[model samples]
Target chain A: MNASSLPRWIDIGLLPVLNLIAALTVAGVIIAIIGENPFVAMGVMIKGAFVYDGALGYTLFYTTNFIFTGLAVAVAFHAMLFNIGGEGQAMIGGLGVGLVVLFLDSVLPPLLVVILAVPAAAAFGAVWGVIPGWLQARRGSHIVITTIMFNFIASSIMVWLLAGMLMAPGQMSPETRSFADGINLPLVYEVLQMAGFSVSRSPLNLSFVIALLACFGVWYLIWRTKLGYIIRATGHSERATIYAGHDPAKIIMLVMAISGALAGMMSLNEILGVQQRVILNFTSGYGFTGIAVALMGRNHPIGIVLASLLFGALYQGGAELDFEFQTITREMVLMIQGLIILFSGALAYLFMPAVVRIYSSLRKPTGSG
Target chain B: MADLWLQFVLTIDATLRVATPLILCAMAGLFSERSGIIDISLEGKMLMSAFAAASMAALTGSPLLGLAGGILVSVALSLIHGFACVTHKGNQVISGLAINILASGLTVTLGIALFAQGGQTPFLNKSERFTDIVLPFAEQAEHVPVLGTIYKEIISGHNLLVWVALFSVIVTGYVVFRTTFGLRLRAVGEKPEAVDSAGGSVSGLRFQAVIIAGVLCGIAGTYLSTAHGAGFIREMAAGKGYIALAALIFGKWRPVPALLACLMFGFMEALAARLQGVEIPVIGNISTDLILVLPYFLTVILLAGFIGKASPPRSIGVPYIKER
Candidate 1:
């Protein structure tokens, strides 16, 4: 069989693993050059990411943010659009959450505040996501360029609002005051205790469950629904989509709005669940990392979930590496992440020939038997 | 009236300095895009070259050597990009973004390892940097009106690199518009199949264009480290590479128009610098953050065709696959 006709298992599962191994090998070489044993560093990373107490919680906490952003990108990718504005979307979404909490935290019940905050965050992010989408659909602007520009605009707007309009009274830092406790999401550890299991107290909250639900929701939307069929059809070919009597422009706007809404959900995790306050730069490159997540996961919900978890491990484990080794700093971790992005994205088909060769050879023997 | 004139002169001077890297980078992008490659790796090349230049200037105390080092590093990155996009048929934008991410991480890692200053090199001595070259008779000519002020304030005291940037515009214009290679380059971007049928190698032309981009980006990076600033800092290129790309689009991917766009952006930057903390009527204290966002905001607006259509090359982002 040819490379393109490879089995789905190898295509989705084995190839990404091979690429991940290649990426890690290069990272290992760099680690060796930096005077650290790559094996030891790998062991430390794995342990820090999963085996240590409270590590899994933090990993999942970060995973929650990636899930939102990754799904956002995945949805947009299905419509042949690159939504690089997730960083900005998440920021504005946080603003939405913060606004809702700040206004109703003292007056409304906890459940009621959450009920209002979720939709508010999605609406704000959708607004941010749609402008670039609209420009691309109606005015012929490139989505990538416009989204990138909006990221900067979103950041500058946030800085101004945080430092000037939203600064807590009597505070010098550029962050709003924490909302009342009623608005805060319950921690996972508390829920686990309620279920009679002891667990480490960590920042993992209700948002993690919501993120899992979103994964299921996205899976259903993409494969089991007509809208997803139209989105995927548009991604395959705009001409065919137009021939099908669907307005490509409307589909683009719809896809981008959905992507933006998913990105906005990140604020519920980052702001209401953990920080309990809106702050500057809290998105912290999660939006960009989402692009990598979508790429590695092959722009599928299941793959995105797995890729998000892997990246979450890298993030938490990379931080552990920084804390443990002088030679392995945060930048080294970023180098590894970048290498993974390079391998998975630009060199996506680089190893396909080799994989196809091996698979064909294996199949020849099995078929004869 | 004279005070306002002096302010204008000074702003124009600052605009040139700020616009130097931007103009160089936009021209670099023009070469790559004009030859059918979407070069978003401009930022990566500039950052890596800036690191090389600063490190060399700091180590050896020769700004010229530093300049050479920067160019070499940038050229290497350009070759890598060509290998991925031209030879391997990879996605151009993904490759460019990967180069940027790789450059960002590698530079900081190397800087921390080499200098031990948390990703910053030691400060360069004034003797090791590209110092200003005051024009002949500039001091004496300052007595004359308008032209004298322009000569003295804007053109007389810029470093050698600034003059080189200005000269590059005419040179790039000639190379892209007048030369046979220029014809082949434009042909390759628009219709690679036609160029290939006409006995030209599409990949070869594209690779050459990428190399030119690398060299120009190197010069831009060198100027940033060795002339505009004292030494290398993490992310010293800032967002100038993307801004350069925006300027390229704003200028509709041409050399002369791109240069004009860069100057306009540079003027906006200089204006922002001057206007910080200065209050204006009706708006009441126009914040620096808003000004900082102006270039990107304008790019989006311009991109939306509020000004006019800014079309890219026909087959710019597509990888040219040869049939056997």
Candidate 2:
């Protein structure tokens, strides 16, 4: 019945599992409160997401973006930094690719341009991210505030640039020129057909692989490398790390730059892989949704993948909710996501009693059981 | 000399109008942040208020009633933020963003359902709207030479909300630094543990701050919908609430400096709006949306550079957990 009688995995994993339950319970209640049958609505949501032919691609399309953003968020989380500017960074990165896709195509081959554009977008996004990181490192400014401000700046610049400079000529709408064909990421036309399950769509592309690679790379960078050790240590105790001969400021900047680059990659993947060009609303809220994914995944790579898939399903399913049940607004899905984050964060603590009881009953099979 | 004077005068007028909403938001932020709430949802709260104000004004044909309704709704939302962050001790950032998303969808859906105008309220004519008001002496003083010109250019005419915004700043200054409630609010923010230890309720202070923020946001929202523009458009609050938050932080969380920060931001916004329609030689033509980006861009750069080492309220964004 004491500490020595506990199962180790139960102790560590119980919190995350309980958080999932709590989130689901809350989301279910919310669905009910909104006058939808929680069971039917949820079932419909799943079917719309996975049952349809092209649905998986649609789900993966959003998941691709969420995973990259979630990774970016997770990278910063490991370093104990908050990069609220991810949205801004992603946006500017989108702009970079949009520009290259639209303007530089005349000079470069499409495949080459696509290859180069992703990195270019990441670079621009990283630059956007680094300013706040630099401020936080050098001047002791709060990244939360500075990055938050930077998001506004980045979005504003996007609006201005898209509405003014990059706007397609002779178009009355306030949008940029249609991306030239060369820079677009390719569909899984061959791969999907061979798999016997792939249905081609407008936004289907190869960025899903790139996103998985990014997740793997982030995991390796944070867990495998010497730099990762220093970053993690500094995040835990900057003063102690400084005492042990590390520059805390340098670590913060590096963490932020890497995070920004990852966020930039998310934007690039979405624009290149899915949208095929940047639009004003190109992201479909992937940047913000990543925050939820990161938290729900507990900032782990595998966890991020799982959480991103769930979020991607919700996003894809939300559209179908409109077609099936006109009353179930897209807002309902967002509400569920928010509830999931809220309850999940708190559920870790809530599950401790049940976990302790289970641990005790297993070790001592007599009265305690 | 005359041309320069003209430019300066024009700039000042633009500064005042743009700054008016910002000042209210900054003051609103001042109360909440001063009491330890990192309010990221100011944008959403203001958005809701603006939506409410515009729609109400259109339906009622009464600006005064619209203003009241706006304040009431925003304050309620602010209370929701307070309850979640301060009482339930939930993650403030998440809760704030939740409120934003909630507001965004709610407003858009309601806009479509009620008005049938695709997230915009029907435009109200001058009689039905909150029109600009010219000060009495200022109007008469137009007969005087340079003084009349200066007064006319600088401060003669503006929406009545502009005056209310300026007055609200003074009120906030007096209430924040000079009053018992204000002291409690600051104490809660800077050192919640201390306040809680000293028999002061941290929750109470937080609730007060949120309500104050909500009221200010409500007024600011009304200004956006009724006073400044003829109708309410979706997401019209745009990024101004965040801009005001930046101004508050840049001003080092002090009332006076916060007002100054708001003014500077307002000037940038106004200038951008003016320049949006203005022709440029080198670029030939520039869209107003690009110009709209100027204030936000400037805020980011300035926050990073000039706002040297600004520290937030010590207990900000962290829910207060009583020591076990």
Candidate 3:
């Protein structure tokens, strides 16, 4: 049967099912090659990610990082800008927190101090985006190349600074000092208990709340505001936007800065809410995964959140795949991630064009009605 | 006099050895980009082929067969990108990214399955690996003037792949500038709408160009794992494709100038690799990972001035929408 004969639109819940199915197809092949039973490994991953104590908590914890970066990438996609420099932005954002917390830690009260750190990190991340964004808008530089280069620069600069001026005292830790203990996200477990909400363990924290709020804010900005209108307009047709008297260059620069600030928040969230310190190589390909999330979500904020959770499960589960299945390596899980992104981003356009056409045709008369 | 000559000899040798893979990959980018596709997939193709070449060479005990195997696999990956972007009118950047992520996963999976070690192939024996070709004239030519010294040090005593890269550059320059197919390829990149109306198939031309790129990148990957160095390692292409993309843009997609851009970046990387232990005057000792960023930083600097002005082929990233 043709794709059109199936449901014209998948249920929002079913999207994950399709993604999981597609992912498993790729993973199943890899598992077979590795001489492992795909079913047993899948079962173990489920147990590892959900049934085990703290497994689900860690899953949501990982998702907290994803939401920030995913929102960061999604914001850029709203304006047809690809913030390929998210990794660079995160590093600079982390450094911004370090710089701010290092000198300004004692000057301000703890609560206000944490509040101030967020904007400072945003500003620092914006600086990282500014160069590539400027070049892209003014010089016709491709964001893909420039942003990739920016990541290298940020990582280099971080390594240089950490080894010299930024190294923590007695820090036998190659990382910065733990954030002043006063700066902390209240233990999620305590916060939940204080509210009289009971659970196995608290994985949801202040940053998780912030991540959800950021998604709502981004959604509002993109769909409900004049600036958002301009962004959507430019993404659709730059020439048309210029014809309408909006400056495309300024829009690109502004949109990219906003995107970078969102990503920079990943650093603040992780450092203040969890890690309490900035370290080299602290990011675990979260920025790169954000690209995958944003694309699979079709640049929708809510869609990105769901995609992040799925990946969160994969990452948490994949971490235990080695223990559960002797033959299954972590690399097999990566194959699943790659396949999902491949089908969603590039292959999807080809995959269901006929269905999309049919659905649109069916709606045209009703929309006109 | 002897010291100065010796220094000169070493510099020339270093330049050629470093420039080989860069040249090959840049040539690959030159073909794909010249035909209107912005091939960010070159990175993925190079990476996957490097893994394939190394693994096959170790398994089969034949370097030549390994080289062929690498080319075939890369071509398959490149063709998928070509089909998606050129045929489906899908976003090129997204498709390129998908291929890259796919390569990363597949290579790692293959590596772990075969080697059972962290995403790395086994080290090769000398019999299975490509060794340096010692020219008969290399030792004999040491008696001549500066020319003999240059030959003995730089030109004569290296892997045959280095010679292939040098020859490939000249041949690529010839094919791009002089051939009818190259003219059609350039025409399509410059104005695909016109080419399409003129009875040339845009998709076909783009596919041909991408395959050319894949083949060159395949050779470059094989060289990286099998010839110049030994055995495939994880993510060994390590931003070389992006550097080659920068080189293509810096050279305005011309073959010879593109070769120069590759050499410049390659030279910088080689210097960084060599300077791992030596302390910089003020900075003191730096980690090799930190030094690796130097080429990327240089790319940004070069792009800020020169790349902004370089005119890309007009139809570079756009899909050829017959209706639009």
Per-candidate local distance difference test:
0.90, 0.78, 0.80
Model 1 bad stretches (over 4 Å): A361-369, B281-283
Model 3: TM-score for chain B = 0.92
Candidate 3 residue-wise lDDT, A163-239, digit = tens: 65778888665687777768866667777678997766744567778888889999999999988999999999999
Give me the displacement of residue A330 in model 2, in angstroms: 3.7
Q: Candidate 2: give the clashing pairs.
A: A160-B290
Location of the lowest summed lDDT over 10 successive residues in candidate 2 chain A: A341-350
Model 1, residue A138: C-alpha shift (Å): 1.2
User: Candidate 1: lDDT over CA atoms?
Assistant: 0.90
Q: What fnat does each of the candidate structures reach?
A: 0.67, 0.28, 0.55
lDDT value, residue B175 of candidate 3: 87
Stronger candidate by TM-score (2 vs 3) = 3
What interface RMSD does candidate 1 have? 1.1
Candidate 1 clash pair list:
none
Task: For each candidate, report its DockQ versus the true two-chain complex.
Answer: 0.74, 0.29, 0.57
Report the error of model 2 at residue A30, Å: 7.3
Off by over 4 Å in 2: A1-44, A98-110, A160-182, A194-202, A324-369, B1-11, B55-65, B113-116, B121-141, B149-160, B280-294, B297-302, B305-309
